[model samples]
Target: MLVPLTREKFEQLIPLIATGPQYKYYWGKFSNFLQRLLISVVIGAIVLLFKVLFRVDFPLVFIIGIIGAFYWFWGPVFQASQRNIKCRRYKYSGFFRGRILDFWITEELIGKQETVNNKGDLVIVENREKRINLEIGDDTGFIAEFQAPLKVAYKAISSGQWAELLVMSNRGDLSTIEEISDIYIPSRDLWVSDYPILRRDFFTEVSSRLDDNEDEDDKPRRRRSEGNRRRKRDDYRY
Candidate 1:
């Protein structure tokens, strides 16, 4: 089940949501210029073939160029728009607080010796991504991996600090980080401020559901304890 928030509450949180990285269409690691050109050429070839075989007068360049732009550029822009919109509907999926347990950048070499006419010359390429492992909720035992952006949250990562991570639980477990900020651990003696309340509340929201399961597990033990106490009392009465 997802947490319910009023429109006004969602609006209040929207600004904070804006603080996170806006949606970006995850275009595969293929370079933009190559993607565009290859797509355009394929589309152009098809358009030209159709024009020749069917004896159509349409200019192949115009048809293919427009289609290429749509697929390579406009399509992704539209997808990004839809993703951010979907975020509104799934807002509850974005609220989770965790302690950063570990962080690492994924590095792999990509080799592409073929396609000579394509953009830049690169026989060997290296890919990198920041992978952050987090321990969520009161159950410090609960852990998950989030593929976060390397450019953001370097200081906190280096300092080994706790964070209020607004993560997106996509298809599976919470894997993508939507936003993150360093949160100073509040001293218990000090009053938790508004921000602190927001911090504490979101974490509780994520972890509280688990507490229900814990409650279910404790019932048997609790009953046994109660039984033991009653038995002891009866013995004393005798």
Candidate 2:
């Protein structure tokens, strides 16, 4: 069933969708190939171990050779078939729109460093109010500590390129994106829910306008502030 999602919720999902499983499907063939190769190696190792331990003279080389060939040629084909089925299921299932906002990569420890200011003072950063620390182990054990404005973190589970349209609020805190399966927006959040008022193309236009506003206002404010600070410092006596 489709559950209604706010604009903030949708925006949060986009990054996850782009860098998530749906995106991974773009190179699904290569991923499946590697999985097959790894499985083949494990099987070959087990067979060789059995032959050494049991002294079974069963045509070990022929069996292992055939297993390797099967995996190398057939694994990806099977995975591709499975992927297609899964895609269809999701298509029929409820879907949502999630748009990607800013994307950045930083060292894992930067979050810790930011906790305290340069003056060795404890600084309380408001955004970290409900921060959750996540330890994910894949490439290596790394900590992910951040506030996912809405439920955007849920969408990050998949990997690859994604595009979405999100909702924005005047305060910026309540803004979010929604993900569309294709180019068309779904009628409802959950497949069974009644359609809410649809605001197509709203986020894209809003974000552009917001960006333009910030660019225009920032330079003058920065220049005036810098000049004021310099004048104050110049008037100060040692």
Which candidate has the top score in TM-score?
Answer: 1
lDDT of all predictions, in order shown?
A: 0.42, 0.37
Clash count for candidate 1 is: 0
Off by over 4 Å in 2: 1-36, 57-65, 68-70, 87-238
lDDT of 2 by residue, 72-169 (tens): 55554454445433332221122223322233433332232336778888875543323222221112221112222223433342222233332222
TM-score of 1: 0.41
Clashing pairs in 1: none
* Runs with alpha carbons beyond 4 Å of true place in candidate 1: 1-30, 57-65, 78-94, 101-132, 139-142, 149-153, 158-162, 167-238
Listed per candidate, the RMSD to the true structure in angstroms reads 13.1, 21.6
Estimate, for each residue in 129-181, the C-alpha lDDT of model 1 and write its tens digit.
44333333423354444443334434334323444433443333334434332
TM-score of 2: 0.24
